[model samples]
Target: MISVEEALRIILEESKALEGEEKNILSCLNKVLAEDIYSRDNLPPFDKSAMDGYAIKSEDTDLYKDGVSIELEIVDLIKAGESSDKELKNGQAMKIMTGAPVPEGANAVIQIEKVEVREDTLHISEKVKNGCNVIKLGEEIKVGDIALRKGTLIRPTEIGVLASLGYSKIKVPRNPVVSILTTGDELVEINETPKFGQIRNSNEYSLKALIQNLGLEALSFGIVEDKKDTLKSKVKEALEKSDIVITSGGASVGDFDFVEQVLNEINADIKFQSVAIKPGKPISFAVIDKKLFFSLPGNPLSAITTFEEFVKPACEKMLGKNMESDNTFPVILAEDFKEKEGRSKYIYVKIKAENGKLYAYKAGSQSSNQLITMSKANGIIIMPEGIGYKKAGEVLSGKFIFK
Candidate 1:
């Protein structure tokens, strides 16, 4: 067995980022950028009017101070997407809409609400400061400026920035294709009514959902029987088609456990057979033909916990992103909890804030087979090894899993 930190380090050190591909910006959401993107032009290509009002020289409104009103002749009207070549001379104003380019020689804009218009003339009651309500050219981003750095995850805001740069297509790291397989003789399809001593297959679907949530493609190979030959055949097929293969069950030491044997038969390089963690000690990791393989525990909670702790970071590394710990917070334990020596413990809990203090309440049973507790939990309390027991109100580090 190896520590979780050592296991993760091995996986990341062996992993390599996938090659880049040019994809349409519309379809690149959540993809990591492969190259730095620079702006081709200023964010606002020209001097823009920030408000829908009259554009006039700042000196024109100077005399209309302290309750005095000044009227100037309206020379032209400029709306968004429209340009005016006419220049504003003294005592002249232009009715410009928001986002419209400011006419030449106009240094300020007065909001329409602040002035009363009579025909082509405008009355401005307040003295407008120079450059007021006007977005100067290149105010936000200048030409050739680095708009986005490499390895940045593309979000909606990033999409807007790319659109402003006229990038219909962008280069991004390719998303890894994951294959999910489940093993057990007592497992039945989800639609079938399980007979005595049989259970429905839930891990496959849960793992598939989790893979999709990470913006990766998942191919399900269904459930394989707990036989060495059958498991070997399924593993071969998954390895041929996917960049990563994840299997649940048959990894622990038992009479029916044959996943390890199958991997050995295939001559896979086993990185680790076990990890020093509770509810997930039976986890296995191997690499076959330069492709990654993860053998998770059979229990539902254990499978999910191991996935979050190990597989998530591996996937991020493959997608050309720096691995970081999931968000965590310090919470006061609402109840006493015991930890086993020489093994880290992950306890499911629900977090609640009261009186500006965060509290973690144990959620249901912490058994690996109990799916109800995992479903109700919003966070996990990590209890390090050697800590015998913790009293209520003791501070513990917790990571939010949901919301």
Candidate 2:
């Protein structure tokens, strides 16, 4: 068995960023930009109005005093999506709505509420500064200017910006196709009642949910018998149809654990068969034909934890996303915890923020097969591989799970 850090290093070294394809802007949400996007036109194509008010020359309001008001004739009215070609004179103003194009020779706009109108005339007692309430053309972005840089994640705001810049489609890295294969004769369908020694298969469902949480689709091959030949054929089939194949059982050293054997038989480069981590120690990683393969323990919690720690990074790299950042932080323990002193332990806990400091408390039993314990936990505290027990008031690294 190798350390978790070394195993992850091998997996990431083999994962490659996939090529990009053109897609509608709406479909590119949460995806990384494949290239820099230049603005096709000025952000505000014309001198536009930022408010519903009168467009006038700033010089026209220069004579206004505290008690005295200045009046300018209202010549034309412009609403949103409308343009006026009529130019304003020294004492003329145009009633313009928000988003309407400001008429030529108008250098400022006085808000409608700030001014009183008396029969086609505008009245204002305050001096209007130049460019006031006017969204100048190209103020935000100019034609041929870089609007968005490569590797930027597309959000809702990016969608609107792309649309405003006349881009209906964008190029983004393709989401990888992931397949889940569950193995074990002792497992039955979720809807089926398990016999005396059998148990319902929850690993397949949990794996699918985890894959979907990354915005990728999952194809699951129902439970395969513990037979060597059958599992081998299914593994080959899954690898042939998917960019990443995940098997949820038969990864340990038991007689029926055939993942490592099958990987060798298939001529795959089996990088590692185990990691020094609790609840998810038996994890097999391999690569063949540009496809990633991960064999996780049959325990439901182990399967989910290994997937998040190992498989999730491969998928993220294929999608051209940042792969090195984690949300871990120093958290003070509020309860004592016990464990063996060999592998790293991920203890599920309920985290609370008190006075700007995070404190972690035990949620329930730290059993490897208990998914309920994980469900009750909002976060996890990482215990070092050299420590067997942690006392209350001790500090350790903690981070939220499934995020």
Candidate 3:
């Protein structure tokens, strides 16, 4: 078996960049931007008033002392969205509202509440400072500046910025369509109660949820019986209609493990046979024509882990989105853990806070066939190769399922 890192490198080397599509501004939220967005024009576009006040020159006010009154002429009254027609001169002040353009030669703006206005003559009691309450042109953003870069995933704030820049449509990468096929003769649908020696088909539903969490769409093809002809037909049909094809249960080395055989029969070039990882050693990858195919283990926990660690990054990177995992953290073990000295082991454990100390305890049995243990686990404590039993207070890097 090849190391997990080597297998991943081989898989990503075959990743082809996804093409982009035109989307309406409303629908482009959270989609990766395919082109850089530059500002159409200067923000504010002109020198404007930042507050509702009287625009005047520094020499217009002589009432520096408190309660002292100086009579000045109100030459013009400007409201928001209106441009000033007259320039400010000595002994003249303009009543300007917030967002109104300040006239040329205007030095300061004294608030209306600070002055008493009788007809066109305004009495200013407080002295005004020079260049107060003014927003310079292009202060927020300049014209022709790159407001948003290409390959940026649009968020709520990015949408607001695009709208402010007068962008009603955006170019973004089309989301990849994942076709899920769960294979097993002993599996039954969720609606039907399982008969003796049969289990409910959980991989399909779980895989659908996992795809949704990555912001991708999943088209489920339900449970497939363990037969060569049926599996080939289904896999071929799914690959034809989907960008990525995923199948479970038929990947492992067993009498019924026919996924790899079917994929090879359909001419899917095998990229990697197996990875050195615990509970997911049967993971496989191949490419049919130009589409991607992932053969995950039959176990639910193994399927989810392999998908997150491998398949998700490939999909995200192809879509031009960030694919780095920021969930890895150092955790203190709550109990001793033993594993083989060569291959890395992912131990499912539940973490808790005890008197301000973070400790991780093994949830249940470590058997790969046991789903109850995986279900009860909150995180996976990573046990690297060459390490023996891990005792309490031993710090090991772990992946957190949730923050």
Candidate 4:
């Protein structure tokens, strides 16, 4: 068995980012950019009005003081998405709406609320500074400047920027296709009623949903029986069709465990057969033909924990993205916890905020098969290896898992 850190390092070191493909910007949400994107034109394209006001020369309002009012002739009216060719003369003002282009010779804008308009003339009561309420050309983004660096994850704001840059399509790293296979003779389809000794196949469906939530394509191969030949055939098919293959169950050294045997038969390079973590200790990792493989434990909590800790980071690495931190922070234990030492333990916890302080208590039973306990947990309290007992009020590092 190896430490969790070592296992992750091995997985990332062996994985490489997928190739890039040109995709429509609309379809590139969550995708990583393959090249640095530069602004083709200045943001705003031209000097623009930042508010609905009158564009006038700063000199016009320079001499105005308290109880003094200045009036100027209205030369033109400009609304957003429109431009005016008329230039502002001395003692002249243009009625400009927000986002409208600033007319030539206009150095500042006085908001309509600060002025009293009567017919074709405007009465300004407030002194305006030069260049106030004006957005200069290229103020936000300059032409030929790097608007977004390579490896940036496309979000809604990024989409807006790409549209402004006239980019209909962008080059981004391809999302890896993940194939899921659940192996066990005791597992039955979700739609069917299990016999006295069988259970519904929830692992495959849960794993599939988790994969999709991570923005990766998931291909479900359904449940493969415990038979070695059947598992081997299904595993072979998944390997050919996916960049990452994940099989839940048949990872431990049980009589029905056939996943390890199949991997060995295919001459796969098994990186680690176990990790020094409770509930997910039997997890296995391997690589075959440059494709990643993960054999998660049969238990639901164990499977989910291993996937979040190991597979999630591997996927991020394959997409040329920095791994997101778990956002772990210290929390006061609400109750005492006692366990034998040997492996790192992750206990499901429900967190409560009291007087601006966070307190963590066990959700319920810590059994790996207790799905309800996992559901009630918003975070996980981590107890490092060799530490056994934790009394109430003790500070421990906890990570929000439901985020």
Best prediction by lDDT: 2
lDDT of 4 by residue, 191-215 (tens): 9999999999999877887887787
- Predicted candidate 1 versus true structure: per-residue lDDT over 102-200, tens digit per residue: 999999998988889998889888888999999999999999999999999889999999998999999988888899999999999999999999999
Determine which window of 10 residues in candidate 1 has minimal summed lDDT. 320-329
**Which candidate would rank higher by TM-score, 1 or 4?**
4
Which of candidates 2 and 3 reaches a greater lDDT? 2
Candidate 4 achieves a global lDDT of 0.90
Model 2 residue 217 lDDT score: 98
lDDT of model number 2? 0.91
Question: lDDT for model 3, on a 0 to 1 scale?
Answer: 0.83
Against the unseen true structure, what C-alpha lDDT does each candidate score?
0.90, 0.91, 0.83, 0.90
lDDT of 2 by residue, 1-403 (tens): 7887898889889898888999999999998899899999997888999999999999988888889999899999999998887988999999999999999999998898999999998888899999999999999999999999988889999999999988999999988999998998999999999999999999999999999999999988989999999999999999888999999989988899888889989999888888999889989999999899999999987888899889998998889887778679999998888888989888889999989999998999888899999999999999988898889898999998887
Alpha carbon lDDT at 178, candidate 2: 96
Model 3 TM-score (2 dp): 0.85
Q: Judging by lDDT, tell me the better candidate of 3 and 4.
A: 4
Pairs that clash in candidate 4 = none
Clashing pairs in 3: none
- Could you report the Cα RMSD, in angstroms, for every candidate shown? 2.3, 2.0, 3.6, 2.0
1-403 per-residue lDDT for model 3 (tens digits) = 8887787787777776588788888888777899999999898798888888888886767555766688878888898988777878888888999989898889777776677889999888766777778888898899999999998878999999999999999888878889999999999988899999999998898889889887788999999999989999999999889989999888977898898789778888988878888868888899878788999998887888788777887787778876554667888987888877766788889977788866789899877777788779888888885576788779887876622
What is the alpha-carbon lDDT for the whole of candidate 1? 0.90
**Residue 46 miss distance in model 2 (angstroms):** 0.5
